[model samples]
Target: MKTERPRVAIQGIRASFHEEAALRYFGENIETVECNSFKQTFEALQNKEADYVVMAIENSIAGSILPNYSLMMSYSFPVVGEVYVPIQLHLMALPGVRFDDVKYVTSHPIAIRQCIDFFDEYPRLQIVESNDTAACAKRIRDEQLTDTVAIANALAAQLYGLDVLERRIESNKLNFTRFLILTTHENARKKTGANKASLCFQVNNEVGALAKVLNIFAHENVNMSKIQSMPVLGKRNEYNFYVDIEWGETRQFDNAIKQILKYTHNFNILGEYLKYEEDTQAPKPAPSPESTKRYITVRKIE
Candidate 1:
């Protein structure tokens, strides 16, 4: 029997990239809840207000989204799926406004940096920080800030009824963002041929202990994708290491993870999710919002 599509929560407003990722995974028109922050999305998922949460985990230009990684390991929610979106930034302002009329431009700091080329000539223009690029666009539209412009996406401009003052303004042409699809339950990445597994571990803070644990994967012929450490807050000098491993359709993945657990403490299974792009090699169109979806929020920044 086919299971019904699940309601999901995504951070940011209607035109946010996170929302686009959610739509791509869940299908457009499925129930969705908009969150003001990543934490709020986590809360919706944890409280069972929504069936799943989708969030940006990393960007090609911006490095890893540390907070999301920390959230992944801290929260009980498991990483189930991943979606990659090609990012094309646009400069927007109230309709009918010319570029010379612009007095201010704002966005998330990371976003401003991503499109530095478009901004360099107007360094004299005040740069302000908003929660995000889309949120900034919404503010400009809502307040009718005629002199103010924003660096965001075309979708944001379209949704907010703003005019694109500039196009593809990102410094890098290959801008793409990677987002994760998360769930409260395990086995989100049910066995499909050729999958990736995310796992966390904490060695005894001894020299070479970390490498020894990784050796297990080497012996098993598993491919490693990423490795990073986060300071275990309040735990003094102790940091947790996150790893992504590539394994073929074989039971050895489970066996290897199980064995690695013995060598480290806090050995947790982050998620065993399938990469949508890896198999399809094509992008999926976003689904419409699901009003009936349940949700839980994990983070909220005021």
Candidate 2:
């Protein structure tokens, strides 16, 4: 008898970016448990419906998914690994459907927003928001709607037997999304040689309290890759800090964490996992903010 394959929960239907990221991390052999929302994805893991979940934490064009941070705090699932998948948006429709036949396009709102440039040329096309990009494509195929199309990935086009109406329609060609692999705390043991960690903490309302915590990491030579502050509810002028750090020396990172505890309240080490460094899918360096300002202005005029 064969053992069951690992069930990986994802936040969208098959061929969505979540599924693509799941396959990148778990290989093609894993079973997928499709969830309607990120909350549902975590619930699937909590209910033991899935062995692991692949969730997008951030995207190059859309910044961070803030609600996911709140969910992580509530569920306290350990992040075991991560994957960075390149994002490529394509406009696809039913087989043999002509571009002129597409009166409306549907997809996740973010997908629509990313392809703003392409849509500008077709001012008459009605854009509709849906829960998932691939789900919209599936809807088009299942409904046999020749007048509708979905802005999704190449995988969605192949999965639904749709023809690509427009390729690489997104305004940004160097888009990528970072996904986190989450599992129950019992199964979230960090692998040996882990070089990165995620931490969350609240600091005492005092002068230099936040800076003192940063100073410790600096002293230990820990590289702070990302830090975000979320407002604490029911409290005025107070916030919770979420931080990601990378370190070259394990001792230095460990020592910084020990020192940081003394200066913080409700300190929690979310997880420590291997940093994603897949060069093949890695993004090109982004343009500077000053250089991008001109492009943003041009987009508004267009």
Candidate 3:
């Protein structure tokens, strides 16, 4: 049976990375429902305004988008797939504007922080923050603001007819963002060939409880790619673990989950999907965000 093109909800305008990621995964025929915020993107799905949503869960440079994980846990949306897009942030502005003429640099706060080194050299330029990188470019083009430049993807420059003042200005050359493809439980259950799984669980506040759970996966030989602990609000010292594991043998992964359940409490399998595979190009190692302050400054335009 031929599947109908899905209505994809994405954060930001059509040229944003979220939209590009969606197209890369769902193809060109899918209809896009642009949302101004990530929360709104989930609301679109919940309200049946969209069939699926493309949400950025993490970035190589910025690390995990923690709030998004909370959103997933709250909305209970099933992750149907995943995509990793190479992020190339460019400095762009209206035509005829030179580097010296630019007084204000604006982009999504995360985008601005990724290019911090580039901005550090230009101390005179005041940095501003916007909700979306593509929207920043759109504002400069729509308002004919020559003094303001936007840091966004090449697609944003093309779509907004802005000139690229500088290309690949991000401090980290290996910058890439991973997006989660989400759908309702009914649609997600119909997916097949999943080799990776995302899970959430809680363990008793006792020594060796968590270790026992980890040992099960180790015994089963399932590669645990990522594990994050989010503190359960109002419950001191108790955390909800979010884990991602990849398995070559489905039977082994199944057995590991079965064994893990015996040691953990309130275990929830968030999703099972095919792992995202990039091209043969190797990524350069970037600084881990654990030591650095993840927060960025933002100045909204009135």
Candidate 4:
């Protein structure tokens, strides 16, 4: 008999939301490991140290995680799954300390932006940046700095044994973070019928050029969920468009792709991912309110 387990690598500290997202995919008692940086998480998967990599691609408030998108585009790790976790930002400080005692707060830049309204209330407070919010809370507690506080999740505050000065400090009440689960295998793509096909390409800037590109999907009857455009580095007046189209197994998507390749330059296939969890009530094949993805980062190749 053999016992099976999931080896998941996530970027951030133990109590970060990425860990929670990995657990949602792998399970609670999952064999979890942490990498300090997003690139390191990708490296761990490339090195075969972990089966999967989970990291935030976009926030409802702060927009796309650009650097990670570059990694996604160049790296060959296929997206195995996706997860969306509602973010509840919290401000935690040393035990028994009042809010007035806080001088500076530390957290990830996105977290800081999400809770800008709260920070704005304390105009004199200093803001510091950290890679992970949970790690900042742990540092605040370990250093025993009552004047210092951290913006992170409630779970992080609990793990660091700090007092919550404020909860749900984000400007938007419905804020959430979306993460992508990547695997090392190139052939390991989604198997479900209702899948999303992601592809990118550079189109000539002639008259009606962009329309001609989209017409391929329109003619194939592939319902596009989202489309985003970014500049192609090192190439002037050239750009890449990332497209996600919803398709069923019975629906033929190859013809549309064939038409695209005949015209587009450096056309690349991102992945076909199975979308899940709609409204936290049911999982359906049709479009979900929160299922639009805009996560592809591009950076200079060094």
Of the candidates shown, which would achieve the greatest TM-score relative to the real structure? Answer: 2
- Stretches of candidate 3 off by over 4 Å are 1-3, 279-302
Order of models, best lDDT first: 2, 3, 1, 4
Model 2 clashing residue pairs (backbone):
none
TM-score of 4: 0.84
Q: After TM-score superposition, what is the CA distance of residue 76 in candidate 3 from its true location, in Å?
A: 1.4
How would you encode candidate 2's per-residue C-alpha lDDT over 204-272 as one tens digit per residue? 888999999999999999999999999988999899999999999799899999999999998888889
How many collisions per candidate?
29, 0, 0, 4
Which of 1 and 4 is the better model by TM-score?
A: 1
Q: Which residue pairs show backbone clashes in model 4?
A: 69-296, 69-297, 70-297, 70-298
C-alpha positional error of residue 120 in candidate 4 after TM-score superposition, expressed in Å: 2.4
The sequence of per-residue lDDT tens digits that candidate 1 reaches over residues 122-204 is 77788888888888999998999998999887667776788887789888989889888888774254646647878887898
Show model 1 residue runs off by greater than 4 Å: 1-5, 186-191, 278-281, 285-302
Q: Candidate 3, after superposition: displacement of residue 68 in Å?
A: 1.5
Off by over 4 Å in 2: 1-3, 280-302
Q: What is the C-alpha lDDT of each candidate?
A: 0.77, 0.84, 0.83, 0.73
Specify the poorest-scoring 10-residue window by lDDT in model 1: 288-297
Error of 2 at 107 (Å): 0.9
CA lDDT for candidate 3:
0.83
